[model samples]
Target: MAPVSHAADRVQSLDVYLNACKIGTIVRTPGDFNAFSLDPAYRATGGTPVLSLSLRAATGGLRRDPRPLAGALPAFFANLLPEEKLREAMEKHHAASVRPGNDFDLLAALGADLPGAVRVVPTEGARAVASAQAPQPPRLRFSLAGVQMKLSVMKNTGKGGGLTLPLEDGQGQYIAKFPSLTFPGVAENEYANLALAAALGMDVPARELVDKADFEGIPEEFDTLSDGKVLLVKRFDRGQGGRRRHIEDFAQVFGLYPSRKYDGAAYHDIAAALTMAVSPAAALDFVRRLALCAVTGNGDMHLKNWSLIYPEGDGPPALSPIYDMLSTVPYLPADGMALTLGGERSFKALTPSRWKAFANRARLPEPAVLAAVAATAARVNAEWWHLPERAAIPAAVLARIDRHITLMLPILAECGAG
Candidate 1:
């Protein structure tokens, strides 16, 4: 790694690697936008160990071109970094060196530990451009794309089982999501929601709500949030011995920028993609998760939330495990879903007819889709009340979820889910 350059005119370029093999180069154009081109050797190998679904052409070949990256990194790369408050926090923490909203520089700073197997490093003579003269702090050199303040921490194998920042060259095994000032009890809410999701037979990652003090390296401000607890979820893309599997979110698949995660695509689009690229069973799993979201009032399942994991790092894609499943209605009672379902966005609008309509549009069998919805609804109604995790939720929030499920039962019952 070269010393951070301060020259305004110096070209900024990064080598993109997957599984430690260089695949392409992303260059910050003279116009300040980014452009990427495949490395000749990697291109000759026929795009093995797939990088992203978005990078594939409609003919099922890699799309090879270079153009202005539109004031940010391409959607796939852009979605790899944190957003909103988390991004602001990182920028503020490294204010003296990294610029605010500069995706290229952010990637150079934290690329070694991005989600999946992809890693970015500055190309020789093309280094990250820093601004101020103040000495910078140690880089928080891992990126997890989301607005929430979370850290990619490694679990200690000692008796107490604490979590801390990954040691040099070590990978984070769990994602520790901290309590948020804006959303109280989110950690507990998510624990209850994930418990319900797992009981409903959705494939969810292993998770637990642990004391915040058990986690080290969390910044002071986030450490002092709503409660003394944080949600720790095992990383699905990582395997034993820290082997990396590749993954890309639906936003990357559809080539939509992260800001447009709620637009330019719908739930039907995702189902259709699953049916086409993955298996019919994968599509059915998606339907079940969608039903879970509706039953739990999880309004934040945007394109970025749904992802495809390459099981073998070079293998075909499958739906990743359920994550970020908090009941948002307790926070914003009027909020709708992050993406539309059958042209409707309201959770109250979920009906059997809508499921049928969605099945028709998504090219899935209507009966299978309806069966998934019924199964998910039945499981939620049956299992949620008995889950011990529900006791951890705040009383008011629990009551809100109770009311939400009660209101949802009628529509689900019409599908014979009750």
Candidate 2:
């Protein structure tokens, strides 16, 4: 009974830690702005409101204790680096020790790397760059190039806390992410994968890893040698100069329609959400790309991981920047695409028969769909090996990845042209 009781308490503590890891704005003081709280369903654990972030700028060091949520969360993230590497990174880049005490000084420290979209004004009305506007709490704040941003907590929502801030300088907005302690390598992995995708000519958000000590919203403990780092990417949705509308996830745009569930309506709604007329041709193209992703070993393609972005002015919405792109299947044994194809769970479902069936159901020309599949396969075969090598992945792992890619090419070729 005593052991059980202890375990229960431990779980509760992890929950609190996980909840605190989410991304949100830090108000200088509580009640400075309206309190916006998400419902319980938004969290990984469906108990209390996992995230209670304030939207307004707050003062102090911008800190929150994670001890409370330590139990419900895992001690480490799935498929990250070994524990030792994480420990070394945390020690080398302790955020607390490097941060300035005030926002103005922090902004001065961040000099030129700041994005052009955000502008940081002085508390007394003097316009500073972004770092000067950081909300001070128990967290450490710093500037990068002059943009004001924080790394306070990871939002409980699985959306990964990527945002496009409006800065005054250039049109480029920032994309921020707060990873959990459980996933120590998430920041580095995301950075690496983003680079990989870009090199492959896939559209991805411009991204980089900010030193934890340089951001005011991140807590000192989180930036400590023992704590993990967060990953931040630059947003592309912003207009030429920072004047852009807010971005929306597919679920929000599609209403109650479930993306993981394949149906005629699902296909139609997806095309409509992109503001493109539904057609068998487009569906085949979309599915072929997705199948290519699977062949390349990306198994984390859930609905929320994809989005449709509307840029400034009138134009049909296109696929949002490719994100959350990873070879999850190779790293995490349990990882797989969230949606099934032809009643099969793995990428193997991209069989000729299944592809034909899906194409027929979507009212697409089977030949076009098959051609798309062949193109994707050819692209994978031609470029896959060169990528891992240039990325400096270990030779052994690269070999395994090549084998997997090779295995999928035959199946993709088998999909007959309509």
Candidate 3:
């Protein structure tokens, strides 16, 4: 097990990496903000940068000497760590009870493996993982991004497509998500939803449902799901040979707290974010994604669901592959959309006129936006009708989705999408 460190004073500086190559450094300043600066070596030989180290492209854009970031840490660094609730398993089984809200401290504790290549340890323990290649003891502990409970495991090319092996301290190429005990068949639902998105030409990561019984050994922590299937999603951020890709969710990019992800931001704000941080071409992709989300009944596409991927870490930014796509309307009939569209919270109110007005407000080409909305709605509706049986979606869930689509047909027609 990795030793947990909470001494905020012990951390002085953090080295950041991209694809296992050093890119920058973060210095600690207790009781104040953390300071980050691009490594002079990295900045000197920079070819094409994607990560954008901060919201400002150049150090001159920031008034601070070293570009001190928000949330007591850099926005990007804070995003590397998962939501507070998502770390319960790590705290309960592996670490100190004291909740060190400081992200630098948490990064110090889990030094060996993290989401991206931006690995950090105290300058002293930074070289602590020399024996990382050795096989580790089996344990029922894990750390993953997002607020959901998930574990990182692997499936090799052996018999039965290889049994699920917990990554231990090594990085995992696939993330295993257990079905929600309170909501039966959620794993299957997410798998089917993601598969549908991929079929619709959305850039989605590969995912599938793995039967729990296929595993020769099941961890005790996952005993509640022994009778069902678990969703295995390929981590888009991690690639072949354990290389890590950089990514930032909308919440982090906008400098909003996870608690305020839905309360403060709307869909247009996301489009506007793309306009400023990325290019107009990338903004058009957001249009198709938003339109598809409307037809798919994925009402829970909150700020955290959308992300900007830095393929080369310091290269140009593009929309990240979609994940966490599911029909939330079925489970929470009482809940509405997580964020508003064109100041309209009611999905039924999104008429053609409303969308046209949204396009004008977001400064996107009205014709392109309209065409994308009409085309995507038509395509997704037709494809959704044929997905239930093929994806093995539960009959009851399929029925709800069918009804949900029916409910949105009139709305789509009002928008001249039919």
- The lDDT values for all models are 0.82, 0.41, 0.67
Highest TM-score: which candidate? Answer: 1
lDDT of 3 by residue, 103-135 (tens): 666665554566655566555453333234443
Q: After superposition, how far is residue 241 of candidate 2 from its true place, in Å?
A: 4.5
Off by over 4 Å in 2: 1-172, 176-196, 208-217, 220-232, 239-241, 256-285, 388-400, 416-418
Query: Candidates ranked by lDDT, best first?
Result: 1, 3, 2
Per-model clash counts, in order, read 0, 68, 4
List ranges where model 3 is wrong by over 4 Å.
1-13, 27-48, 57-72, 96-102, 125-143, 159-161, 165-169, 215-226, 276-278, 313-315, 388-391
Relative to the true structure, candidate 3 reaches a TM of 0.83
How far is 281's C-alpha from truth in model 1 (Å)? Answer: 1.1
**1-418 per-residue lDDT for model 2 (tens digits):** 1111111111111111121233221112222121112223333233222111111114522223223221111111100111133323322232332222222222322211222222222222222222333432222121221111222122222454432322222232454555544444555555655665666566777666654543433334333343345566655545443354323334333332232223313432353334332234445546655765667677656544555554344344456677666555445644445555544556766687766665565556667666776777776666666664235433444455566677778878786444
Candidate 1: where is the Cα deviation over 4 Å?
A: 1-11, 125-137, 159-161, 167-170, 221-224
Candidate 1 displacement at residue 280 in angstroms: 1.0
RMSD list, candidates in order: 2.8, 15.1, 4.4
The digit string of per-residue lDDT tens for model 1 on 1-418 reads 4346423245477889998788998887776878888998878777787887777777866887657776688778989999988888767655554688888777776778899889887787775545565434455678899999898899888887778887435689889888877878889999999988888777899999998878777766335466646899999988899888888999988988889988979999999999888988899899989988888788999999999988674467899888889889999998777898888878889888888888999999888888888877888889999999999998998999888888887776566543
Task: Supply the global lDDT for candidate 1.
Answer: 0.82
Weakest lDDT window of 10 consecutive positions for candidate 3: 91-100
